[model samples]
Target: EPEALDPRLRAPDLVDRELSVGLPDAATRRALLERLLADVPRAGDVDLGAVAARTPGFVVADLAAVRREAAVSAALRGAGSDPSEQVRQSDLLDAVGSVRPISLSGGGTLGSGGLTLDDVGDMTEVKAALTEAVLWPLRHPDSFARLGVDAPRGVLLYGPPGGGKTFLLRALAGSGDLNVFAVKGAELLDKYVGESERAVRELFRRAGEAAPALIFLDEVDALAPRRGGSTDAGVADRVVAALLTELDGATPLREVVVVGATNRPELIDPAMLRPGRLERLVFVPPPDAAARADILRAAGRDVPLADDVDLDALASELDGYSAADCAALLREAALTAMRESLDAGEVTAAHLATARRAVRASLDPAQVAELEAYARRRSDG
Candidate 1:
């Protein structure tokens, strides 16, 4: 919250409220946000974290989402109105009643995991890029300062669906001391209007609190769908507003990394992908042939197979499958051997035949093509 640093962004009296809502105390956190929101002004833009100073650990994304719900209910009422019957506290209250705040990502996306460079395998280019972009800047903020360099607000991860986007993210989270906050795009969905807007605020708030935390939004297409494509009218607007404000203006403590992943990267709004917003976009392509053997060996090492089982042949047979798909196939094979108790003995080439025959590929050609097409439609990233 750079606004916190600037002092120029806060109001004179403060919002004069605390999250004091009580709904059977489902979660002490949400209940508190509800209470704080109760005293918030009925109108005007809200700076979530600023508003939530007293409600530490409250998920701002959930609050933003609830806010959207409030807006929608206000819209639905007086559809046939006398135009001057202005939206009121009652309307906001009604929206609140109808909606439920998200309970997931106690912080933000990626569930607050941490990591360093050692946990990953074979993502040489990616590790190099991350170290340069994420590590070097933090390690030498002074160097960056001398160079007149400002850190990136966020990074967008896009790629072939099974190319280890999630795995890479996990590895990033697993790496040392990087406070990871993972947000689920699906959690942005809400029953009412103001809710989504509030969730956006909550996301930034939590991210700020968990400074030096990496906020990972997996399948970000759902949270910040492309401007023209979003079905929810005000959602894109509020999400964009909150997200851009935080990323572009907020002074995140040195350790925070905001990463969003999407299979349909093209669907994330332009403001989100812009240079000043999520400035870095790293595309993870499906593993090339060179990576296939490594992926196979990693997934297959634990399986009890006959010594005669040809790993190279097995890898060859699974050509075109993504790392995830390859793992699924290996799992399917091993499971079959376990199930049939075949030969009451070692699983062999004959066992491999059974597994191959029994297992169907998780992703079909058409689906793969669709994912590929979506990747192609996005920018150089």
Candidate 2:
């Protein structure tokens, strides 16, 4: 069983001492494959070790299915051939491709979208912090254990909307090989009583099974608002309680981390910001001049540009622009150029200036002040 067994069945009156069987390692998987294919004809090119290396978190049953699929593939390929034509490496690889990992097939999704740290233009400090909070734990677990330190349990990224908080989360998820269970805060709320809490429990359970996984809750304020003053009839409070329990409950979460993003950090329950829950609160401020320049360059990488276009000046002018705002500016610039004439040679400075004038910055002075205050409070705390 991938999940917890019933407590009643574990009583002395019913079951004996329980034994846990974990997923097979590479050597174990190779040996199991050899055992299963002992009677089956396999091609010389077939390498069980390579196949085992590719299939992580695969159980014996999954290996059996792979063999069955491979056999079927071989039969289809070797029609009207000798009885010992054998299953080729290609057949086995195809079978592996067809078989999804149990974690993704059942609960969460795989975190391999080809988005790396490079995809995120700037935010060097934020990227370093995330790496320490997330990647360091998985990469240097021994160092942490030796130092008698517990890795950060959760990271909360708070910033203005369209500041690339979600994009940063996705990049962190894609930086390594891990399972990512992404859920919007609104999606977790249920109309029925207790169902919301149960959903939170199950989400954590799935994340545990897929250890080294990331549980990303976008717009976290929706799920965990300040308690006792909500208009939702205590639904958010219950969900927050459930979330707190899961974050620092009796059962330790090994190789699992929770990441949350919100535009309103002030609205989040203070309990969630405690040491054991979302210990690391990072303020994702709007992109600076260099970041804006990078965003503009990236957005205009393929678009034809005229000699009059000055990215540096444009970046300086768009001081408080978020990443999304920079993208929109570029898009608006292209549209402006297109509107000027059907044969407008390339995007020009005039077009970019018009776009810049049209699209206002999203973050106002008050919101910026609030974000700054929150950052100071976090540091003081």
Candidate 3:
């Protein structure tokens, strides 16, 4: 489960009151908890609440399970139900508590919509460029650096929204045995001034220890928002500081790769763009014909379609659709077919035409013209 965004996610230094302990046998549970606490608690730490406060890494889920089982037991007793079935002795969860170790400050997963770089069918030049600039170096960090030394520390994958940049990042790291630390900026902030900073320090420290790691930070704007002239001083600032230190610091984890993704790269701190920081920046644009066809095949190869579903014409019409958009359109068509099948009879050629007619190109004609003009303008430059 995700870390609770509320105050529950942050543990306080002290406990507020004595809460009732619920277990199969209170005597054994209390005894075990006291034993664990007694090993670490200072003098005058006599209360159960105090003991709990002292306990680190005590999972709330386990405690909830105990309380739930106890409630079930009580209800069964009132109903004269079978004690064994109501709440078995094994229902009590173990209360083994230990200090939770810290981890990296900024790492999080991109959306796992299965849109890999492979799923992106077109833009061979874009794909090749990204590979040579980012993946090739990552594969042979020392050789690419040409110094028999460390590789690029971090890579920033930034592009337009719905461009499948994040999807590419996930495809690059979803598997293949890389230790990934994913942090969501929206979820990592703490009101306590240094809590987020501490977490950040711990996160990088852990990543170094677990080298050959991938740190993926999504929606980095929350941490590295454009440092304006007059922004409020808060925990966000500390998180930003911690982020810089981790990214730029001379860590021994030579194989560690940091990947930060955002739709609005302009909103990020300018300093991060420097080489050896987020030295590599790859821009993922919308799909071309090859990519659109691949995305459609990947999305709807399994779905039964009529012979009249013109893949070429569909691809031509979907000039500006990203891999994500292509998949969405395919799903929309499939859903329409499913509904039509249930509502009437089998889906036919006319149904596919109906679906295609209903589905509109995401980009306006003006935007397409502008993009073409911009690409050409850059060529002139």
How high is the CA lDDT of each candidate model?
0.62, 0.82, 0.57
lDDT of 2 by residue, 59-112 (tens): 788889999999998887777876557899989988976776665676445344
Winning model by TM-score: 2
Residue runs of model 1 more than 4 Å from their true location after superposition: 1-121, 251-253, 342-347, 362-381
lDDT at residue 103 of model 1 (Cα atoms):
40
Clashes of 2: 0
Candidates in order: C-alpha RMSD to true structure: 16.8, 5.2, 12.9
What is the Å distance of residue 248 in model 2 from its true position?
A: 0.5
lDDT of 1 at 212: 46
Q: What tens digits encode model 3's per-residue C-alpha lDDT throughout 1-381?
A: 123335553446444343433212223435554454343312232344433332222334444433455445445554655433333222222121112212221234333343345554455655565556546554676676677655667777665566665555666654333445677666677446677887777677656554456677776766676555325565666677678887877455545677787766666777776776776766555667866776677666566766677777777677666666776777777677777666543345566556766666674556545545544553465
| Regions more than 4 Å wrong, model 2 | 1-102, 106-114, 336-346
* Whole-model lDDT, model 1: 0.62
Model 1, 217-289: lDDT tens digits are 7888887876666566666667766677777756454446677888777678877888766778876766665
Q: Hey, what RMSD does candidate 3 come out at?
A: 12.9
Higher TM-score: candidate 1 or 3?
Answer: 1
What is the lDDT, from 0 to 100, of the residue 380 in candidate 2?
90
Using lDDT as the measure, name the better of candidate 2 and candidate 3: 2
